[model samples]
Target: MTGKRGRPSVSEALARDERVVDVVIALLTGDGIEALTFDRVAAEAHVAKRTLYGVFGDRTGLVRAAIRRQHAYLGDAGDGSSDLRSASRAILLHLLGDEAVGIHRAIIAAAALHPSLAQEFYDEGPGRAQGFLASHLRAEAAVSPELLFAALLGEPHRRRLLGLAGPPTPEEVDAQVDAVLRTFGLLR
Candidate 1:
């Protein structure tokens, strides 16, 4: 018999995991998060359920990993937000838009009854994004950006995503950025 094959490279492993997350996100966007069962994801990604389990541990694990992966796409840690006033509107609307919003709602809903998953979402999302905005303000604009960042963070936007309200228009989003910029003394 042939000797055991060598372990896969890190990039190979991550490529596999990334594809799974991509399929999950696409499915979530198309079918809704509640419909993204392992079976469905397996069929979509052309992988076995056993493979999903092996890579992500379980359903929650899969979701958390998928969310965390997508979360990086929107991560603000290194990217500049100096143009945040203009970009914020696009970013916020997009964040609260169709592709990103469902997973946010699903994770938040999941987190409500599940502490571990909640913590995971917090770490990957609000915890990181809000903090990055705060740091950006401190470094590029002003001091004590905490309040403004918090105000800019969540709520009605998320509400809009879950059929609780409507999406913010460009005018609304711009008004919010103006308000936040004023708070940071970046604008009048």
Candidate 2:
């Protein structure tokens, strides 16, 4: 990811770009936003500074790209029956993972300094994740799947983000899922 160099050969750019983003995420998780700079990221990523600038245009762009990369872990679309509790559980777990938590923190910290960047990250990331999850719930509809989705995808996760709670344990997740099922009359 050495960003210090001029343009790489076409084939090398894709891999370098990925490495740059990966290095940025690693740096972000280790140190908060204040500690990041193009020079530091170039050193950390092992890329030439010039190359980094060529790809991202500026430090702000790099920050945006890195945040976008972390959030993009949630996929574009999903296809699963809402009735399939196991699949639903997996999605919930992914959202609450430590890595996801780190990304969420970085975005929040960055947002305090840069509102536009935060907005871009939200539009590119969480909104997409919610839409993908919403679509899956739509597929799962035995009936009133949105209600189930709302419960499963709602307060608990955001409450975790607000530092009001940590990720729920598997037992707790099961209870939450079960509550959704009972409320929707999916469980006997």
Q: For this target, which candidate reaches the highest lDDT against the unseen true structure?
A: 2
Worst 10 residues of 2 by lDDT: 73-82
The superposed Cα distance between candidate 2 and the true structure at residue 174, in angstroms, equals 5.2
Q: What is the lDDT, from 0 to 100, of the residue 111 in candidate 2?
A: 86
Local distance difference test scores for all models: 0.66, 0.68
Over all chains combined, what TM-score does candidate 1 have? 0.67
CA shift of 140, model 2, Å: 10
lDDT score, residue 177, model 1? Answer: 77
